[model samples]
Target: MPRQRTGGFHPRPTVLVAVGTDKHRFDRLIGWLDDWYAGSAARPTMVIQYGHSRPPTIPGAVPFLGHGDLQRAMATATLVVCHGGPATILEARRHGHLPIVVPRDPAHAEHVDNHQQLFARRLGAARMVALCESQAALTAALDAGLAQPRSFTVTADADVQAARLAAVARVGHIVEDLVAAAKPRRASARH
Candidate 1:
């Protein structure tokens, strides 16, 4: 079984790569990230922040926190590349971390709705979030954003309330699932 790596990266330019997508979207994103990062002379270190216990180690890539540490670790990252979830976005902003938002597609079923798409659209418009739509876009946006970030207090964001509401909904889902699990299954009597 795959496990979260608590040990941090050794000393290279660190970039946090957070994902909430499955294999397909993940493979695509990883390939894209690798291709983009290949040519850079800087050779920045990457820490994969994800779940399902799959070893995220990609040779040059560094292993750090898994899904659980995502929010906390991302808060301390120099550059955060994350799935476009409101909570992740809010968390990155909370730590004053510069972010590159990668929207996981609907086809991947990464999320119920393509909130990433909507969030990307809004943040990209304001230039607060680096909306990486393509492999090339990732590099271009990363370069520009890293050069000079426009920092602001994360609490100032309007989406904070929405993230809090979403957290409540998630808790509700967990509780419902637990209740369902605890309930005894009804059985039919055989003739």
Candidate 2:
């Protein structure tokens, strides 16, 4: 089937992979993507932000990208594959792509905890992300995305965006309250 364009989404054969700026190595995800690329005859244009992981075999791989550059790349890409960082997933969604998220596994020493997996599962349950925990799943998601690009493109939902921003602000307020509660009280000076 020919690729479809929906919601101003152009069918481009580009893929952007972001492993985040965490200190832990996400070599597993990089390796999986590289292996998949090697076997793909279609050869989608791929750019990877490898962060602290060992260098990828894929060309066009960069250690990091500036915020403006990353957003620009996301705007043009047909697909986004990213580690389970919520910010990256949100960025992809903001750019109209439903990201394929591979949560870093703590068992593989890819993270200090399994928070990524937990957060990703919550987003996956809401259909906000295409969660792929295994190489086979990732391959299938990528194949589907390449074949029918529009399926992954999402129109901006103003209500949903507002809700997300509100939630983040609420969390920030809670954190501030907690910090205030923990701080020692300054005694009044009676001169």
Candidate 3:
């Protein structure tokens, strides 16, 4: 016999924090979120995966989450706060959550380059994600997003869809090139 769903439905707002799997720490974003959570009047259920970043000294914060666990958390989350990586942002969108993005800064040593900042700005301009470059911006976004969560539904316009496809193709090509370069070369038989 199959198990049946038994629990009565009770809606509770949830927030998911994903800081990516980079080697460098994103303490700036973690600390800011901690402060925001502490100051908020109506606190939602918060699930955080700090990755290589230091875990916040807050009640619900955790150092890391496995892939399946992160997916499960995101599925239930009303809001997603994440580092501005293309894959992470897309994953949040795929889960029907428009993420509030804080890009890693090279100057802050959060990344080796400022590509995330540039990507976040472009995505923000396209209305795909909320860009939070500073604590004030993050706080404002959090207040608004938590009050009313937005759907990340892509429009059916052909031009927009084409543009998105092209951008994704470019990123795919870049990833392919990087992977190819990282592969070990075979030794010459004539040597």
Candidate 2 TM-score versus the reference: 0.82
Per-candidate TM vs. native? Answer: 0.61, 0.82, 0.78
Q: Write the per-residue lDDT of candidate 2 for residues 1-191, one digit (tens) a residue.
A: 11222635454488899998888899999889889999987688888999999999988899999998898888888889998876777678777788899999989999756767877887888888899999999999999988888788876655776478356435534643553455444222332
lDDT of 1 by residue, 99-144 (tens): 6888776665554445467766777787656788787888876665
By descending lDDT, how would the candidates be arranged?
2, 3, 1
Give the number of the best model, judged by lDDT.
2
Which lDDT values do the candidates have, in the order given? 0.57, 0.80, 0.75
lDDT of 3 by residue, 1-191 (tens): 11111222327667889997878899999899989989997588888889888888766778788878887887777788999777777667656666799999989999766778887898889887889999999999888876656442233345564467457537834753563455334233435
> What lDDT does model 1 reach?
0.57
Instruction: State in Å the error of residue 18, model 3.
Output: 0.1
Which one wins by TM-score: 1 or 2? 2
- Cα error, candidate 3, residue 19 (Å): 0.4
The top-ranked prediction according to TM-score is: 2
